[model samples]
Target: MEYFELNDGNKMPAVGFGTYKLTDPEETPNTVDAAISAGYRLIDTARVYTNEALVGKGIKQNGIPRDQLFVTSKVWISDNGYDKTKQAIDSSLEKLQLDYLDLYLIHQPYGDNYGSWRAMEEAQAAGKIKSLGVSNFPDYQITDLAQFNKVKPAINQIEINPWNQEKATVDYLKSYGIQPEAWAPFAQGYDHIFTNPTLSQIAESHGKGVGQVMLRWLFQRGIVSIAKSAKPARIKENVDVFDFNLSDDEMKQISELDRKEGVSADHTDPKTVLRLSKYTTNLNGLD
Candidate 1:
């Protein structure tokens, strides 16, 4: 697997597994087991994902050594600020059942982000986390936070996919030495985006799935992508992206599929931000 070096000099697998809505209580542990068994080393989770404990259980059940796995989690908007963030990080670590996090991110641009950033920074120095970052932050949020914080974010997780290409924001974030990690690299199958005619045609020609085509496109673009799959077959399909490379023409064909529409909650929307903050997840919900 290819790895991207963050600004702070840590190496993260360019392609990893994402556990977002995958926190379904009944399905998470087995799904996580499948992912790790399939050779996925990086697992992304959040307090909101609520399956950190299950993820931990899977890690233990699979008997994978902790150092061999890279786990990423986030502190939510309501838990922003130095004290709260510090507490939240510990909460996440405890939930994940790990001694140290490979990476931790502020869940949103809202809340006391600056104050939270300080805590993230201090946590890094305190050795609670190996890397720190922000998720769903805009370009200005990237610049604003970087200028003020002593320890700039190593990675910025954002919504990215064939339809919602974040090229501009990716460029902007790269300017600040922040690695761009994609959260929804498939656009959640909206509008049949991944299975579009052009993408499928390209995949067919290369004997690959449309989703695989999209992942190849992202990898070629140098963006670290975290893809999700609850099914075992799909989980293996998602990670089996390293064998093929899309031609430049095919890559541009895939890029032309961009519609600039997001599948999940748009971070730029205040109402979306408000809604995300309103819901508090527990082991039952997040599991």
Candidate 2:
């Protein structure tokens, strides 16, 4: 349950539950309920996730006070531009059954991200969004956005794991006082993440699973991490990382496991951007 202070003077949980593909419509609510009960205060969702309403339902069903929870959602690539992003924000609020979001992000760097950022700035000024940021944005893109806007991005959500540490990009963002958040922190199990021998040994030393060790590694590095799991036991394990710490040598061992570029799309590529912009999510039932 460790927390980090954003430049805007707000606290964000260092570890969060990410609802990326929890798309059962029905399963989403129950999974969210399990996460909250397991001591998760941060719930990350996106319009593309198609589970915002279910997340809201879970929050209400859990009966946790709104003030005690940290809710985050994102504007989708298809919903770019100032006007569309503004409407998307209201739609996200309605779907989440909340008045305001703890954090809101532009889901990608494509489309009218400049416009999308402007709309998020207005939303923040209006108190509808406490913190504004971008997910999957490269360092230069973040800088480009920050140059013209008065409110710099408070965070940058990126793919960060043992395989893809993103140190250069992360350091660049930190120079601008932007906190780095790790999505798919486990590398989605790619490259035999959970079964890695080094991580396994580290986990054994801490009496924790490899997943916990991975999160502990990120925590020690001062990065916020969101690990996704539908099982209540896994959810509990993800949040249980606060009890132990990874030694510098152990951390370096994990760092040595780095393969450099694994388990992420090349978002900077025009082909990828075009493909992502073409994909549309169906929020029909959830809405």
Candidate 3:
């Protein structure tokens, strides 16, 4: 698999397996194991996802050496302060059964993010976290955090798909030397993405699936993507994007399909911040 060199000088997988909704105790670990067996090295989980333990189980079951896998987890809003975030990091390590994480991110932009960043910096210095980043942060917030913090964020994980291209944000991130990682790369199948006429035509030409076309598009744009699937076939299919290449015309055709719409919660909305803050996790009983 191809890798992106982070601003911090760490290497991250270009394609990863996302575990956002893989919550079933029996299914989560098995699917994670299947993904690794299928050649996925980057495995993403989160404290809020409440499945870190299961993800850890899958990693152990996969029997791959710890150094060979790239594991990532996030600290939730409830654990936003320095003290709380510090504890949250240890809690995540315990739950993930990992001595260190490849990447650790501030899951959202709310609460005392500065405090959270400080804690993460400490963790990194202590060899607990390899890289530090933030998710769902706009250009301004990320810039502010980077300007004030000693360590600039190595990555910014956000929604990037056919519907919401995030062109300006992506451009800004690239210019700033920060890697942009795509979550919801397929837009979570929104607006019948897999069956869209434009993508379908492109896939037909490439002899691939619509999902593969989407991932290839992100790859050509120099964006890292994390795709999730419970089915073993689909999981394997998701990572099979390395073989094909989308032509310039096909890439433009897919870009034109962008509706400038987002599938996930709007980080700019106040209600989103309030709602997310209200949702608490049991990580070290922070709530």
Candidate 4:
């Protein structure tokens, strides 16, 4: 349950419970409830996830005080203009059954992001969104937006795992006082991540699983991470990373695992950008 102070002087949990693919309408609420019960204070959801209402139900069911819980949602690429992004925020609040969000992010960089960022700035000033950030934004996008925006991005959510460490991007964002948040912190268990000898050896030494080692490495590197799991046991295990430390040698061994490429989609591709722009499915159904 470690925390990091954002550039705006707010505290964000270093480890968060991610709700990326918790699509089952029934499973979403149950899993979110389990995560909250397992000591998760940060709940990350997105409009594209289409499970905000379920996540809200879980929070309401848990009965955790609103101020004690940190809820985050994002503005989808389809809702990219200033007016649309602002409307999207209110829609998210209504769906999540909350008055304000702890954090709100521009879900992608390929949009009228400058316009969207302006809306986010207005929302923060109006107190509807406490903090602001972006997801899948590379180094240049942050610089381009931050240079002219009223409020700089507080964080950048990107895919960060051993195979795609994004060290350079993280360092660049840090220089602008932006915190780097790891989305797929375990590479989604691709390439036999759990059975990797280097990670397994380190996990063995610490009596932890490979997932725990990956999360610990992110924490030690000062990156915020979100790990997703529908099972309560695995959800609990993701948070049990603070009990041990990774030695410098062990850390280096893990650091050397970076391939500096995304395990999933490539946001840098123009085709990806064009594809996202056409993805106007109206995830929130507010349009």
TM-scores for the candidates = 0.95, 0.97, 0.97, 0.97
Compare candidates 3 and 4 on TM-score and give the better one. 3
lDDT-superior candidate, 2 or 3: 3
Quick one: best lDDT, which candidate?
A: 3
Per-residue lDDT of candidate 4, residues 139-200 (tens digit): 88888898887888899999999999988888888888999999989898889998999999
User: Which portions of model 3 miss their true places by more than 4 Å?
Assistant: 283-287
**Which stretches in model 2 have alpha-carbon errors above 4 Å?**
283-287
Worst 10 residues of 3 by lDDT: 278-287
The residue pairs that clash in candidate 4, if any, are: none
Per lDDT, what order, best first?
Answer: 3, 4, 2, 1
* Candidate 1 runs further than 4 Å off: 24-26, 283-287
Tens-place lDDT per residue, model 3, 154-235, is: 9999999999999999999999999999999999898899999999999998899999899999999999999989988999
lDDT score of residue 116 within candidate 1 = 88
The lDDT per prediction is 0.84, 0.88, 0.92, 0.89
Superior candidate under lDDT, 3 versus 4? 3
Q: State how far residue 236 of model 2 sits from its true place (Å).
A: 0.4
Summed backbone clashes in each candidate are 4, 0, 0, 0
Query: What is candidate 1's lDDT per residue for 163-261, written digit by digit as tens?
Result: 899878888887879999998888877887765889889999999999888888888988999998888899998888899889989988877877888
lDDT of 1 at 156: 87
